[model samples]
Target: MAINFRKGIDSSLDGVTKLVFGAAWDRKAAKQSGFARKLALKSGGKINLGGGQKDIDLDLALILYRDGEPKRIVIGHNMDPVHGAAVHSGDNQTGEGDGDDETITLNLTSLPAWVTEWAVAVFAYKLGTNFDQAQNVSLNVYDASNQGSAVLLDELMPTLGAGATASIIASGKINRDATGNPIDGWTTTLVDKAGRLGSQGDDTAVLAFAKQNAGI
Candidate 1:
C-alpha cells in the first residue's frame, strides 16, 4: 500500500490489525545533568527537561492515550507493556548499527477497551543535538502481520535540528464505520509534524500534540 504523511495533515489507517513504529539515530556522546537524571527516574520520563536512560542518545516512546490524555508511556528505562497490547523492544543507546535502532510493536486487536489511541514518537535524550547528527531516518510504520511490509513513508520523517527534541510521527485509532458505528478493529494515521514543529517537546508536549492531531 502507498503511504504518505504531511505536517499537520490527518491521514487514515483504519482497519489496521498490527502496527510498528520504528526509528534510528546516530548516537551523540553526551550526558544529562544529575538533577535531570533524578527527575527522569522519578517520573517515568521528563517533560521539557528531557529524561530517560540519562545515557541513551535517542529513544522511541510509545504512548497510550484515552480521551486525548496520556495514561502510560513506554520509554528507555520504563519498557512495561500497556494492557498486554503494546511492547517496547529494549533501548538502543547508540544508533550505530543498521536497520532500526529502536522499535515498538502494538497489536490493535489485543488492546484494552479503554485504550483509544497509540501515539508513536521519538525524542533525542540529549536536547543539544538534533537529527543533523543522525541520519534522515523518517520514523516509519509497518504492517507487522503482513511480513513486516513498509508503508512507504521512509523519507517522510523530517531531519530536525537540535532544538526540535521530539517528533510525533504517527498514530493509530480504533475504527468506525461510515455510520459512525464502532468496529472491532483499528486504523492508522500518518502525522509527520517535524517541519514547523518547534524545539520544545517532552512527554507532556508529545501527548498533547498526538491527542489534538489524532482525529479521535
Candidate 2:
C-alpha cells in the first residue's frame, strides 16, 4: 500500500539503516509450522554445484495470503560475476530440519490484523574465494497462509562482478481461487549488474508484481 523509510535505532548494525517502509513482519511466522515447510521441496531442487567465475549471490523470500492464512517462500542462490551463472540454492522447502539449517525466523503476533500476507528474502553473496564457499543470506515475512510457493520470479543467473549487486523485483497482487488458494496474477524478474542497481532495466521485470502490489 504505502512505503516509508526511517533511520534505524536498533544496534543491530552501525550507521543509519532504513526502517519500516510499512508494516514489517518477521522472517517466519509461528516458528513451529507455516510457509517455511512449503518451500523445502523447491530449495532442495535448486542448488548449483558447478564451479565458475566468482560473483555476488542474492537470496529472496515472498509472503502471500488470503483470508488470514500466511505462506512463506524463500529463494537462496549465488551469482557468478565472470562466468555469468545464476545459481539458485533452491527453496528451503521445510523449516530447519537437520544438516545445514539455513532458514530465517520471525514473530508474527505483533503485526496488525489487516496484514493478511507478507514475504521475506535473504541473500548470501560472495561465499568464498574458492571451494567450500558459504552462502550469507536471510529474508522472511508473516501472513495468513503459505500459498504463494508456485510462483517463481526467474531462474538464477550470473551477473557481472563482485562489485555489482544482484537485485530481484516481483510485482502484482495475490489472486486466489474459490477456495482461497493462491493463483497466478503477478510477474517476477531478476537482474545483475555493476554498481548499485535499482528496480530498473531488464531487472525491473523481476519486481513487476511487487511494484504493483507491495511497491517494494
Candidate 3:
C-alpha cells in the first residue's frame, strides 16, 4: 500500500537512534546484554517455538514515538502482522506453518516520562540449516504516518552465515507516511536473504502497518 505524508502530523523529535541487539554468530562466549534482557522482559520473558521444520526463528519488536510520546503500533505476527493483528502466545519450534510473533505499540501523546528514545528488538534462530553466507537480514521502518508509507530508517543488514545464533536491536524515527502525511507513527519490514533452508526458502518479506496510520 502507498502512504502519502503530504497531509498529517510530523514529529519534531530529534534524530533517530538505531541499536542492534544480538550475539555475533562467532561470539561463542558472549553473554546476554541489556538489549536481550529488555526484549525478554517486555515480551513476557522467554522465547518459545512451535512444531514444524527445524529452522531459525527471529523475534522482533519495534517501539514507535513522536516528540518523546509513545505511539500505538503493531508488527507482523503471522503474515501481515499489522493488518493481521495475529497474537499467538508462546513460541513454536519445528518451523511450523503457524506463526509465532509479537507486536508493539506506543501512545504517541502519552509516552513514558523516562523514555528518551525508541527501540527495535529482534531475535534470529537457526532452525534446520544456517543462513547463507552471502545473505543478510535487514529491518526497515516505513513512514506510515501518511498515504505513501515512505521508509524513515533502515538498519544495516546483518550477515547470519557465521554459524552461530544471536539477536539484534536497533532504533529509528517515526517519519511521515508514504504520502508525506505525518500521523506520528511508522511500520516495519523484515527482509531475509535468498532461501531459508530446506524449502526453496520462500524468502518471505513481511510488511507491518501502524494502527495509527489507518486513518490516513
lDDT of 2 at 191: 25
Error in Å for residue 15 of model 2: 44
lDDT of candidate 2 over 1-216, digit per residue (tens): 112111121111111111111111122222323344445445783543333333322334333333434332323432221121112234442233323233322223232233344433222222322111223221221121234432221222222245333322222133456654435422222222223333322223323333333332
lDDT by residue for model 3 (84-155), tens: 221223333223232122323333334333323344434332344343321234443333333443344333
Backbone clashes in each candidate structure, one number apiece? 5, 44, 63
Q: How close is every model to the real structure, measured as TM-score?
A: 0.66, 0.23, 0.32
Off by over 4 Å in 2: 1-60, 63-122, 125-162, 172-215
Best of the candidates, lDDT: 1
lDDT of each: 0.62, 0.28, 0.34
* Error at 179, model 2, angstroms: 18
Report the lDDT of model 2 for residue 194. Answer: 24
By the TM-score metric, which is better: model 1 or model 3?
1
- Candidate 1's displacement at residue 44, Å, is 49
| Evaluation by TM-score, superior candidate among 2 and 3 | 3
Query: Comparing 2 and 3 by lDDT, which wins?
Result: 3
